[model samples]
Target chain A: MKPSQRLLVLLFSGTAALRGGGFFDTLDDKTRFDSDALGLHADLSFMTDATLYVPELPAQGLLTSDDHVFFVPRLMTFFDAQMGDRLTLHTQMRADRGFDPGAVPDGDVRLDEYYLQGRILRDDDLNVRVGKFGTAFGSWAKRSLSWNNPFVTAPMAYEDVLTVSDRKLAPSGVKFAQRRDLPDNKTNWLPILWGPAYTTGLSVSDRIDWVEYAFEVKNASISSSPEVWDAAQVGFPTNPTFTGRVGLRPAPEWSLGTSVSHGTYLQDSTASLLPVGSSVNDFTQTTWGIDAGYEHGRWQIWSELIGTRFEVPWVGALEAVSGFVEAKYKITADLWTAFRWNQAAFGDVPGLDISWDRNGWRSDIAFGWRVSENIQTKLQYSLGDKSGREPEGNHLGALQLIMKF
Target chain B: MKPLPTLLLVFAGVHALIADGTIEGKLSVESMKPSPSRPGYLPSPTKQPVLKPESAPAIVYLERDDGVYPRTKTNETVRIRQSGYQFRPSMVAIQTGTKVDFPNLDEEFHNVFSCSKAKHFDLGRFRKEEASPEVLFNKPGVVKIYCEIHQHMRCFVVVLDTPWFVKTDAEGKFSLNNIPPGDYSLKIFQPSERLIQQRVTVTDGQTNTVNLTR
Candidate 1:
């Protein structure tokens, strides 16, 4: 066959293979049940962010325009029969078209998350999962598609601490889980136990699985080299990382969650000024946060209070606290409007009293319209206030179209 | 001409023996604030314009020809219309062995199913104007009705043991006649609302009233 023909055949085969796993038709229950018993899903998103750099931090990458798009199509399957009568086999495969290094020159796509899982024992009291699995930390981590999240990107605090460089869909492990109902019906009581549910932080969810307290933990080691950076200026080193989360679901429509992590970051070495050579341990970061949400009727309200504690060689201990509130109202059957406010304060050190505290306040408003059952359009505007600088803001509007069969 | 006087007397006697009992009632929101269980406070059934004070209620009529015991029931054509991909009456109460005919009056097709423990069956796809599918409800309980096509479409099928039941009108009133002057329980079912049950004694021409709010 000709080269063109061979390429066409390969493309068709890949599409068929992904489609056959049943990931594309999970939204509709009848379609999922009537056509096949398997579950399939696919999500794609594109976003452009513009930031303004203040004179104080003008040297760093600030006030820059960055546009990123990612296409992550995933396939999952479930066997009709259980593996061990108590265990059932479940697996997933993902192919990405646009997950690349953040500093890449232009549009870049790289390999993303992939893994498998199996239910060890599914009973009224105990349910165990073993194998390579995605992180299961918070509500947002499990449902990470930009199309699903209210914001285009993750929270800045999470991005700063967690290692998101490589598209780790399923952290490459073993996990066990147990859920028991308490005695009283008048009081809502449910105790749960969970862990490695079979995987580590290959995916964002794996890092936050609810093993012990509606939360999960991810531990891994990564090493990378980029051609855009100077080799002599910064030494490349492998660093081990850890991330974990815990959540509480007291009611059907209410949830509270918290996450914490401490890890090392490979960065440039500045030893000339130090008395000892290589005395500086590249970089280390620690972050922790808590959030809660309540949804009732046509209204949804959520608040997240988060903080980050960082200690670099020369930078010493830097601490930051952020609090944000968001509200969503459903105007019509398929239309909704949301408003969010965020305030963050940074401290130079843990206990020192300082004259100036780096701070930023942001307000965002968004209107979303479901044009059709499968397509949606959203328009959003954001304004930010930064300390020691003028108020800066940007407006972004997007029309997103999605279809599955 | 001579038989005219006798016929007029007979008609007057028969009219005196017949008793017409009327039933009426209203459905309203307890408050503007959305309840945790029921968020969308639908309009009060009493506020509907078509259901005026005089024509206050929507009634289903059934008559006993002999006006006595050993009742022989007749199947009443109760239409559960499907419009805008939703069931018109979110809640419905029927007697045991009563056959319910689900008719799709919408332009699009629908898939109706009941996952309730009492009855579990999926009535496959049915198109517009097609003959409705009928199911004989033999159990007494609340059976949840859902449309597979629309995730939000939901309704209830309340099956009861007794066939003697009435739905209130726009005026919030209901009357059950020919009750045989016995004591029984009155069960009311409504969508996204609470379940109401009351005990009452019925005499030949006595009238009872109940007002409910959720």
Candidate 2:
């Protein structure tokens, strides 16, 4: 960011500096119930966040001019039901960012997850989940909800624009790399790891002593968005993405985990764009990450480091590293503050100084207040700096109010 | 519903006939804090409770070293009622050996229990508007009460060794009449406040008007 923007952000987020934590309660008795004799229980919770933001419109990047000084109101609903002690069902529905065309207030609603889980062991030492589920590649997916996550926006690895595309292969490596500078590359440019990355899949996870592990076979890669998560819209487990994770909790307050995923990064639509003899499977994206967290009392510390390598038809390969370290503390029973330092750095081509994507660093700070037992309000500010770019515009100020019942 | 003080006055019939003194006082609590045993919540229950701070009552009693102090009648019974989502007065003071009746007034099931060190007991679940099995108070200390299903609902049972205890009204007024002439120790108990103790001399047929604020 430029000097003026830096000063603006510092002045904007200075009051939220004493980073802290709280796990908010966003569910009520009316929305949750238990039947002991029937061995049944269910809960339905809704979270709505209204964000007023100042978007730095990159010339040829993800944010458009329409994003400047606008309010993006979004709502998400979660449903969970359990039968007996071993079988459970879960689902998530969302309506956000104006899913409708022309940025209309009439947003389209989408179902993000509908899955069933069964604990094979009486002690839950062995468990299996089938149907649509979030990719088991990282821990970020676990805390993506408004009540669990301290920040409004996701980490850079999960939301920042990447030079790689799943819908269309870059015409040329040089041109692919150039698009990150000053061009309109909307949905065509994908994030290294999409938000939640809820893909159609089946996974088997188990907990043994202090260690937990899981493996998943999904229809699409981590970069695939909501539009291609279903089997009909994408591949049906034919050489699908493979994800696995292993976590260890040696103590009640600290957790350490690592994950790996390898998958074909191209869609069927790209079949027509490949060379005469090349197949969609020729290109792939592989990612591995490590996550760590320490939560004791009112202080919580979280960190994740991800390394990804994508092979393109023209560009032999592009590698990048993205991650973040965040901390939050509960200043009081009703108030909390948090701060995150995140960045995405791409490796330079073999001989050229240009990387596959623009390297950027960003800092997000937020303060949250509990308005009541069922409501919370968060004020957040983000400062971003893009390397080798013009019209440096990546500063945003947002206020989000969430009411759950 | 200042139930205990009214009951204490009636129960004082045996001691009022003798040469006695009276103690009346005004009490005000600066804050009504959460129960110490309240389980830690994710977003801890923000702010002080909304249990109407102005209605927080004080229980004041006198403990005397005089050997002739009257003993409470064995099996003396007292009734504390439950209505809506709360205990009728939310608190009460009673002498040891008193038999307490906890009757559910709401047309719903309610479980009365206390994990207090003074007296640990669970009255079990009662049917709609059913009378609870009598719980005899044989110990002298504060017993915090709760319902199994409704975590927010709470009540306190202050068991006293002396029968000269009375609770304050909404205006922080309380009167302890018909006390035996003697040197006594004044003790006060508030569920949300610290225990307060003071020394006093009760002269025959005299009224001691004392006031306290914290």
Candidate 3:
């Protein structure tokens, strides 16, 4: 056997002697890895979802012309190496497929998170994390895993589409025109905020008594499209984006917090969209939100309100406000029922006539069953309504199965 | 001759006072501030209720001096029930060589384990209808127990070589009956409180009352 394998076997033997049996005999439920061992540990989990969408009216823009059904699958793998008790390395990779409504099915694999975390002063009082990781802005980002989240989809604030394309088109193919007859002006394609939900950054966090706080600096702005950093583009912004959050525990069953992010949103290639010789900082995006959660007995509830403002040069100013409240009740030890209301309001751009920019809201209801410790199934139905769209309302049904190991 | 006989009888009676005594005490705390609660995020069920710190009981015992007391045998099985995601009798006092049976009374699965100095054992996950395995604790010290799946579930077991120990009631009252008359060190243990020790003396066939406050 290899040296590492022999070493692992010896370590397990010693642990068994100390613990009186195999490592799995005790089952360290908090972490997936064998924390007793100091070397590498691995974990894997996956989710498969089948969704059907039906439109109340003739579908337009990104939506297909008729009813559509597709399957979405995602796989996540994590590797953790503990150098010692004070320092550790963590890396997570994800493979996802079937998210784009207008494109053909394709699988995309990427490194979702990679970080090296260590203690600075004390284990609980102070710590520093460097590298790419999920944003520590709100409660949802930290608990968005398939097994952790009650619903299949993310919150509207994190997935709302911003702009479909860069240019507006008319019969003459004139770009950037705000005419109502322009085909591009009516296009519904838009970039979602999923990119900003994860970023490369350095964060300092601490927990003191009932309060916890974190402050981070990342390479790009909140909701910036094409999240991957390209150092070749205008020599990476000197002043990076800043995000922070503070949470408080007032009662054993309640938690309240607030988060904020501010930074330049325009890239070097998109800098000309603002004005001639305008610096990237001229178009800045700022977002702030308040979130609260409560769990007691057989009921759990979570709510958040987020507002984002974009400072543009010619298009006046634009603002988007979104909020959601979700609640779940356990019908039994293995069954749960949940409901959520999500809504968003966008300020009209002076010269733009995109229908997707209108106000929208959606309601979702779901029932979930835990078939076993490693398997869970959920059935959810959602209704959506938007003003100034061909399909003023839509219906969606989804069934998801999750497996963990 | 009758007076001499009576004197001999009194002398024998004075030396025959070997019966056990009773130690009664009330354990009170200065304040019972509730701990701040947080919503369950991962690995824990959202339906579980928070356990009030004041409702949990404390453990009280008389420390045994080596070679002064006989090693007691505990044949009766002490059961710690798990229901509503909380350990019933969150605090318990047990004699050395005692057998503890952990039964899952709730509908969900529960895995009970302790990493404390007194004993280290993990009763793997068991369902409500499954038979609970028993553990034998032979050492004497504090054993901190926790549910591997539920972070909020916690319990403490105080094991001692001597059989003279009792757990405080909800009203903070405890009675240790049939304790042999002697002078020994008394100890009180409560979660999140400082360990308390005092010298106590018991008289034969009398109930010694002690009020422990901190």
* Best model number under lDDT: 2
lDDT of 1 at B47: 11
TM-score for chain B in model 3: 0.78
Instruction: Score every model by TM-score.
Output: 0.44, 0.63, 0.58
Instruction: Mark the regions of model 1 whose C-alpha exceeds 4 Å error after superposition.
Output: A1-106, A124-139, A153-239, A267-283, A349-357, A390-399, B1-214
Chain A of candidate 3: what's the TM-score?
0.78
Query: Model 3 TM-score?
Result: 0.58
Which candidate tops TM-score?
A: 2
Per-residue error for A300 in candidate 3, Å, reads: 1.2
- lDDT for each residue of candidate 1 in A74-184, tens digit (9 for 90 to 100): 222222222232333333332222221123334443222333333222322133333344334333444334345454333332221111112121111110000001111
lDDT of 1 by residue, B1-214 (tens): 0000000000100001114433333433222211111111111100111110011122222223333333233265455666655576655667666777788766445667664545555565566666887887777676766664453456667665555566554433444544544444444553333355444444456555433322
Which has the better DockQ: candidate 2, or candidate 3? Answer: 2
The sequence of per-residue lDDT tens digits that candidate 2 reaches over residues A1-405 is 645345444533532331111122212434665555787766676777665556665422233335456555677888877788678888888787543111344456778788988868664457788988778887888887777788777787887777678777666767776766754355576788887888998999877777888999998899776678877455594678899999987855678999999999887788888877988888888999999987654677899999999877766788999999999876764578999999889997645677877788989999987554345678888888878766546687667666555
DockQ, per model, reads 0.02, 0.04, 0.03
Alpha carbon deviation, residue A150, candidate 3 (Å): 1.1
Q: Write the per-residue lDDT of candidate 3 for residues A1-405, one digit (tens) a residue.
A: 545345434533343244321122223232344323544332322333333333343332233334444444566766655454456677777666522332224567667678887767533447688887777677787667767678766666666555423232112212322332222221332332443355677899877767888898887766653334432333457667799999997655678999998877665665555467767677677889899998655677899898877665556456778888999876764578899898988765645553225567888888987553444667777777665444333666666666544
DockQ of 3: 0.03
Q: What is the C-alpha RMSD, rounded to one decimal, of candidate 1?
A: 21.1
- Measure candidate 3: CA RMSD: 16.4
Q: Rank the candidates by TM-score, best first.
A: 2, 3, 1
What tens digits encode model 3's per-residue C-alpha lDDT throughout B1-214?
Answer: 0000000000100111236666666654445422211112122222333343225566667765653556564887899988767777676788888999999877556768665556867665576767888999998877767774674576778887777777666566667766776777777676543366766766665444443334
